[model samples]
Target: MEYKWIALSNTTIGVLMAAINGTIIIISLPAIFRGIDINPLTSFQYLLWILMGYNIVTATLLVSFGRLSDIYGRVRLYNLGFLIFTIGSILLFLTPNTGDLGAIELISFRIVQGIGGAFLFANSAAIITDAFPAKERGKALGINQIAALAGSLIGLILGGILSVYYWRYVFLVSVPVGIFGTAWSYLKLKELGLRSKGEGIDWAGNTAFGLGLILLLIGVTYGLMPYGSSQTGWTDPYVMASMISGAALLVSFVFIERKVKYPMFRLELFKNRMFAAGNIASLLRSFAYGGLMIMIVIFLQGIWLPLHGYSYSETPFWAGVYTIPLMLGFVAMGPISGWLSDKYGSRFLATLGMVIVGIGFLLLTTLPYNFNYTEFALMLFFMGLGNGMFASPNTASIMNSVPAKYRGTASGMRSTLQNAGQTASIALFFTIVILSLESSLPTALATAVTNAGAPQLVPLVHNVPVTGALFAAFLGYDPVKALLANVPSNLIPATAIHIMEQRTWFPTAIAPAFMGALRNAFYIGGIMTFIAAIASALRGKRVIAEEKEEKEVIKNA
Candidate 1:
C-alpha cells in the first residue's frame, strides 16, 4: 500500500519483462527459424541480427534516455517504455510474413522492444533510489536484481516449453505481462525523483555516443560470422572500418561531453571512488560472465545431452532443466548478500564474490566433456552464488554514490557499461572459441569422417566453417546432417550414412575439440573475474550521498 513498495513492485515487473525478452529468443531460435520458414545455415546474417539487435539498441539508448528522464521525469519515461515494449511484443507475436521478410520484421520489432527496455533499465534503479531511504536501497535493489535474474532463468525454460508448441507462443507470453506493467506503471507510479529543470538536450554528445556504440556493437556482431577464408570476420575490411570509426567517435564523444553545457553523461561523477571502482568492477564482472550461460548451454545441447542419448530437438529443453541449479543459487544468495551489504560496506562482500566466481571458473576448466552431473551442477551453483553476491551490492554502491539529481544519468551510465561489457564479452568468447577451433577442427573432422567410413567426404567436411558448427551446436542441430546436405548419398554406403547420422557420433567426435576450446575460454574468464575482484576491493568504502543530503536539508530546515 505504501508508495515505496508500489514503486518497487512496478519496477520489478518492468525489469522482469525486459530481462525475459532479452533471453527468450536464444533457446527458441531454432523454432523461430522454423516458424518463419528460413534456413539458418543460409541466413546467418538474420540470426546474428535477431540475437544482437535488441541489446545493441538497448545499450545505445540507455544513457540518452536516462539523461532525458533526468530532464523530464523518470516515471514518465518509464511508463512510455512499458507501452513501447508491449507494442513490440504484440507485433512480434502477430508477425505476418515468412522467410527473409519475417526474419527482418522480427529483428525490427525486437529493436523497438530494445528501445523500450532502454528506458526501463535506465530509470528503474533511479526510481527505486528515489522512493526508498538510503538505508533500505540495497535490499530494495536486491529484490529488483532478483527479478531480472529470475526472469532470465524463467525465459530459458519458458522458451523451451513454448517453442515446443509454437514459436509465436514465445513472443505471445510477454504480451499480457507487458500490458499489465504498462497500465500499472502509468496509473500508480509517481514522479518521486528530482528532475534537472531547464537542462537542454545535448544532441551532439548523444549523437556521437549513440552512433559510436551502434557501430562498435555492429562490428562485434558481424565479427562472429564467417568472412572470406577466415572462420571469423575479425579481419574483414568493413568490420575493421566500423570498429575503428566507432572507437574514434567514442573518443570524440568524451571531448564533446566535456564542452557541452548540460552534458547527457555526467563524467565528473566518476571522480568519486565508489562510483568509478564500482562501475569498473561491474563492467569487468559482466565481461567475465556475460556469455557464460550461452557457453554452458552449447556444451549441454551440443555435446553432453546428445552423447547421453537425448535427441537434438530434446537437448534444448533438458539443457534448460539441468541448469536450474544456477538460478537456485542466485535466488538463495541474492537477498542475503543485499542485507549484509546494507549493514556492512560492499567492499568486502562484493570482492569476495568475484573471488568465488573466479574459483568456479577455474573449477570448470577441470571438467572433462563427459563430466559427472553432480560436479557440473555444483560448479554452476557455485558461480551463481558468486554472481548473486556481487550483483546487488555492486549496483547499490553505484547508485548510492551519486547525487540525487543525477541518479537517472548515473543509472544509465552504469547500465550502458554493463551492457557494453556483455556485448564485448560475447564477441571475445566467440573469437577465442573460433580461433581455437580453426587450429584443430580440420584435423579432428578429417579423422572422425574417415573413422565413420566416409573418407571420401573427409575433404568436404574437413574445411567446415567453425562459425556454422558453433551455431549448429547452439541451436541443437545435427551438424553432420547439415554438413552432408548436398553430398550425393549414392556415393556413400547406407551403413556409413546411418552411422554418421547417429545422435552420438557427431557430438562425441566434436566434443574433444570443442571442450578444449571451451576450457581456454574458462581460463580467460577466470582471469578477468579475478581482475574484477581486485577492482571491487579497491572501491574503498561505501558512501551514501543521500544521507549527507538529508542532513543538509534538515540543517537548512
Candidate 2:
C-alpha cells in the first residue's frame, strides 16, 4: 500500500512501452522491411503477417492473462510480462536475416513483443485498481490512459526518427525502459487485489477464445489481400470459410465460458448495465478510431506529406508530428473529463466526446483530397482532440460502473471489445480503400499512359493485374515502375516514364480513386464515432441514476 506511487509509476511505464510498440512498427515498417531486405509489394503476405501477428498474440492472450492475474498474483504475472517484453525487444533489435527468412524472423520477433504487450495490458488496470482507491482510481487510470495514447503518437514520431536514422534504434528504445520498469515493478508493485485461488485455470475457455480470435484475425488480415484479381477478398472462398468457422468457434467459446467453473471471460459482467453499455460504446469507438489512424497515416505518409514536398521516408516522422493534435486534445481534456465524470457522471463527457469526434469527421469530408495543408492539419487536430475526449471518460465510465469484484473481468471485457474493434476497423477501412481503387484505376492508368505517348502494349500492360496497381500505391510501391526497363523506348516522352517512378506520382495518379475511398471510409467512421458517443452518454446517465437511487435507499434504511 505504501508503494502505491511506485505501483502507478511502474505500470505506467509498462503500458507506455506496450502502447508505443503497437504502432511504432507501423511508421518504421518501411525501414523494418529494408533492414531485412524485403519488398512489401511482392512480399505482401509478410506485411500482413508483420502487422497481424502482433495483434493476434495480444488479443489471444489478454483474457487468459487477465484470468490468471485474478487467480495468481498480478505482480508475479506482471513481472514475467516485463521480462518477456524485454526479451522480445532485444531479439528484434538483433534480427539477423534478409529476404523471406528475415521477414519471418521479424514477424516472429513481433509476435514475442505482442506476448509482452498482452502481459502489460492484462494486468495494468488491476494493478492500478489495487494501488488507488475507487474515487482516486479514475485519476490514476486517466493518467495511465493518457500516457498510453501519448506513447502511441510518440512512437509514431520516434519510429520515424529512429527508423530513418537507424532501424535498430526503434526496438532499442524500449530496452532500458523495459529494464528499469521491470526491475522497479518486481521491487515495488505489491499484489493487493483479486488474488483469488479458488478459481482454477479455464483451459477450455482460454483455448477456445484464443484460437477463435486468432483464426478470425488471420482471416480478416488475409481477407484484405486481393483474391484472383478482385480488389477485396470478401468472395474468396478461403477467407469466407475462415471467417465463418472463426465466428462459429467464437460463439462456441462463449458457451464454453458460461459452463466453465472459472471463466476467463466473465459473461455475467454484461448484466451490469454500465458495464454492457460502456463496452458496446468502447467497441464501436475502437471500430471508428482504429482504421482512422492508419487512414490518416496513408493520407499523410502515402499522400499529403509527399505531395507537400516531404520525401516518402520523411512522411512517417511528419505524419507522427502532425498527429500530435490528437495527443494534445487527449492531454488537455482527459484528466478534466475523468474528474468531471467523477462528479457530474460519465454520460455527458462520453456523449460530448463522441459528438466532437463526429463533427471532426464531418469536417474531414468537406476538404478536397488535396486541400490546404493548414486546413487539413486543423481538421486532424480537432479530430484527435475529439477522440481523446471520448476515450478517457468513456473508459472511466466502463470501469466505474462495475462492482469491485467484477472490475478485473470488466476491464478485460472492455479491452477485448476495444482490441477486437480496432482490428476489425483496420480490415474494414483497408478493404474499402483497396476495393474502390481496384475498380477505376486500370482505365485511368490506361488512358493516362496512352495519352503520355507510345501505344500501350496489349499483352505486357494487360498482363499487369489491378491488384498490383492498388498494392503499388498501398504499400507505397509502383509495380509498373519496378519493371520500367522492359518497356519500349516509344512508350511516350521520357519525362512521362520518369514521372511514373516518383513517389508523388503514384499517390497523385491514384488520388481520384483514393480520395473517394477515403471519403466513404471516413463517412462510415464518423457515423460509428457518433453512435459510440450516444451510447456512452446513455450508459452513464442510467448507471448514475441507478446508483443514486440505491444510495438513497441505503440512507433511508
Candidate 3:
C-alpha cells in the first residue's frame, strides 16, 4: 500500500476506536452499573460523570496535545495515544471493586482513555492533510470522518451485544484493536508535517485555557444536580462561582494568547473567512448532532421500544438496531459529497447539508411518542445525510486554509470546539429535558400512582428526582421498579404492584411528558442547525488564488 493509504488506514482505526468508546457506554450503562452493583437511580451522579467525563477531558486537552504534537511529532503522540487508550481499556475491564468504588475506578480510567483520545483527535486530520494533496483532501477526510461518525453508531450495536454477555467485555473489546493499531502506527507512520523548532511552550496560556474550560464544564455538570429545595442546581453558589470564574479565565486566556511569542493557539488562523466560518458551523452542527442523538435514544429506548412490545432490558439493543439507517445515510453520502466539494467548493454543499439537517429536526418534532418506525428511521437517515455532507468538506476547507506549520494547532482547535460542543450539548439538552420534566413529572406520577390504586405511594413516587427517572430510562432500567423498590408492600396492594410493573405501564405513563419535552428539544435542535446553515453559507467560496495570496502575505510578514 502507498504511504498515504497506510496513514489513512491507521488513523481511521484510531479515530474509530476513540469514537466507539465515546458512546459504547450509553447502551451498556445498565449492564455496567449492574456489574458494579450500583443502583442507576441512586448513583445518578456517577452516571453523568462517566458519560461526560471522557468528552470533558478530551475537550480540555486537545489544543495542548496538538501543540505538543507539533513540537514533538504527530505520529509519535498518536502512537502513544493508542497505547494509553489500550491501557485504559485494560484497567476498565479489570476493575476489581464493586459498588461505588468500582464506578469511581471506571470514571478515572475513562479519563485516561479521554487523554488518549485527545491525542488521536488532535492530530488525525493534520496527519491526513500532511499525506494527501489539497485537491484530494476532501475525499480522504470524508472517508476518515465517516469512520469517526459511524464508529459511534457501531459502538451502540457492539455495546448492546457485548453488554448482554458481560459488561467487562464492552471495554475489553477495544483492547486487541488498540494493541494492533498502536503497533501498526509506531511501525508504519512517520512525521511528515512541518515541526515548530526552538519555540518555548506557552505555559500561562495553556493553564488559563485548560483551567477555564474545566471550571466552566464542571459548573455545567453540577448545574444539573439538585440544590436545596430547587429541582436543579443552577442557583447553587458554587455553580455560579465556577461559571463566572471560568468565563473570566477564558477571557484572560485570549489576551494571553495575543501577547505570547509561542502561543498554543493560532488566533491568526481565524483571519481567513473560511477558517472562521467553518469552525463556527462545525460547533453549531456538533451541538445539534450530539443533542439530537441523545434525545433520539431516549425516545427509542424510553418510549417507542416498550410501546412496540420490546421489554425494558431489550430496548437498548433494538434501539441501536433501529438507528442503523442513520449510519447508512452517512456511508452513502459522505465520500460522494467530499469529492463533489473538491470540485465546487464547500459553501453550497455544506450549507445545503445543514439546511437538510434542520429540516430533519423539524420533521422529528412531528413524531408521535409511538411513532412509526419507518418514519422515524427516515428522519434519522436525513439527519445523517446532512451531517455527512457537511463534515468532510468543512474539515478540509479549514485545514487547507491554514499554513502548513500551523496545521497541528488548527486541527486541535477544530477538535476542541467540536468536542466541547458535544460535552455542552449533553448538559444543555439534558437540562432542558430535566427542567421540563420537573414541572410536569410530579403531577404526572402522582396521578398515575393514584389511578393504579397506589394513592398511598403517591408521596414517595412524587418526590423522586426527575433526573433519577431520566437516567433510569436512559440506562434501560424500568422506572417503575426503581421508584417502587424501597416502598413497603404493606402500603400498596399486590394488584397495584403488578399493574405498575407491567412493561408498558411506565413508558405509557411517562410518554406524554417526555414527548412534550422531546419535541421542544427538537425545536431547539432545529434552530441550531438552521443557524449553522447560515454560518456555512457565510463561509463563501474557497478560492485557491486568494488563499495563495493570503499565504504569501503571512510568509512575508
Candidate 4:
C-alpha cells in the first residue's frame, strides 16, 4: 500500500481500538463489577468513576498531547500511544486482586489507556490531513471516523459476547489488536506532517488548562453522587469549590495563552469562521450524540427489551444486536457524504446532517414506552445517518482551514472540545434523568409496590436512589429483584414476590416515569443539535486561497 493508505489503515486501527475500549466497558460493567465483587447499587461512585475516568483523562490531555506531537512528530507519539494502550490492556486483563482494590486498579489502568487514547485522538486527524490532498481529505477522514464510531457500536456487541464468558476477555480482546497496531504504526507510518522546531513548551499554559479541566470534570463527576441529605452533590462545598476554581483557572489560562510567546493551543485559529463554527458545532453535536446513545441503551435494556420478552440477563446482548442498524446507517452514508463534501464543501452537508439528527431526536420524543422496534430502529438509523453525514466533513473543514504547521495543535484543540463535550454530556444527561426521577420515581415506586400487594416494601422501594435504579437497569439487572433482595420473603406473599420479580412488571411500573425523564433528555438533546445545525450553517465556504495565503504568512513570519 502507498504511504497515505498505510497511514489511514494504521490510524484507523488505533482509533478503533481506543474507541472500542471506550464503550466496551459500558455493556460489560455488570460483569466487571460482579467479577470484582463490587455491588453496583452501593458502589455507585466507583461505577461513575469507571465510566467517566477515561473520558476525563482524554479530554484534559488532548490539547497538550497534540501540541507535543507538533513539536516532536505525530507518528512517533501515535506509535507510543499504541504501545501504551497495549500495556494498559494487558494490565487490565491480568488484574489479580478482587473487590475495591481491583476496581481501583481497573480505573487506574483505564486512565493509562486514556492517555494513549489522547495521543491517538490528537494526532490521527493531523496525520491523515497531512497524507491526503485537501480535496480528498474528507473521504479519508470519513473512513477513519467511521471506524472510530463503528468501533463504539461494535464494542457493545463484543462486550456483550465476551463478558458472557469472562469479564477479563473484554480487556483481553484489545491486546492483540494493540500489539499489531503498535508495530505496524512504527514500521509503516512516517512523519509527513510539518513539525515545529525551536518552539518552547508552554508549561504555564498547559498546567492551567489541564488542571482547570481536571477540576471542572471532577466537580461534574462528584455532582452526580449524593451528598448528605441531598440527592446530588451539586450543593457540596467541595464540588462548588472545584467548579468555581476550575472556571477561574480556565479564564486565567486563556489570558496566559494570549500573552505567551509559545501557546499550547493556537487561539488565533478560531479567528477563521470555518474553524470556529466547525469546532462549536462539533462540540454541541458530540454533547447530544454521547447522551443520546446512553439514553437509547437505557431505553432498550430497561424498558423495551423486557416488554418484548427478553430477560434482564439477555437484554444487554440483544440490545447491542438491535442497535446494529444504526451503525449500518452510519457506515452506508459516511463515505458517500465525505466524497460529496469534497466536491460541494462541508457547510451544507454538515448543517443538513445536524438538521436530520435533530429530526431523529424529535421523533424519539414521540415514542411510547413500548415503542415498535421498527420505528425505534428507523429513528436510530436516521440519527446515525445524520451523524455520519456531519462528522467527516466537519472534521475536514477544521483540519483543512489551519496551516500545516499548526495542524497538530488544531487537531488537539478539536478533539479536546469534542471529548470535553462528551464527558460533560454524560454528567449533564444523567443529572437531568436523575433529577426527573427523584421528583416522580418515589411516588411511582410506592404506587407500584402497593399495587403489587407488597405495600410493606413501599417505604424501602421509595427510598431507592434514582441513580442506583438507573444503573441497575443500565447494567441489565432486574431492579425489582435488587430491591426485593433485602426484604424478608415471609412478609410478602409468594404471588406478590413473583409479580415483583417478573421481567415485565418492574419495567412496566417504572416505564411512565422513566419515559418522562428520558423524553425530557431527548428534547434537550434535540435542541442542542438544532443549535449545532445553525452553527454549522453559519460556517462559510472553504477558501483554499485563504489557506495558501496563511501558509505564506507563516513561512514569512
TM-score of each: 0.98, 0.93, 0.97, 0.98
Q: How does residue 75 of candidate 3 score in lDDT?
A: 87
Candidate 2 C-alpha lDDT tens digits along 119-216: 78888877777676556666677778888988888899888788878889989999999999888878777777755567788888888788888888
Residue-level lDDT tens digits of model 1 in 324-366: 8988888888888888989897898899999999999999999
Compared with the true structure, the alpha-carbon lDDT of candidate 1 equals 0.92
All-Cα superposition RMSD per candidate: 1.2, 2.8, 1.9, 1.7
What TM value does model 4 have? 0.98
Better of 2 and 3 by TM-score: 3
* Error in Å for residue 258 of model 1: 0.7
Off by over 4 Å in 4: 545-547, 550-557
Give one digit per residue, the lDDT tens place, for model 4 in 491-550.
Answer: 999988888888889889899999999989989999999999999999997855346876
At residue 433, give the lDDT of candidate 2. Answer: 74
TM-score of 2: 0.93
* lDDT against true structure, model 3: 0.89
Question: Model 1: residues >4 Å from true position, as ranges?
Answer: 550-557
| Candidate 2, pairs of clashing residues | 454-492
Ranked candidates (lDDT, high to low): 1, 4, 3, 2
**Cα lDDT of all candidates, in order?**
0.92, 0.76, 0.89, 0.91
Give the least accurate 10-residue stretch of model 1, judged by summed lDDT: 541-550
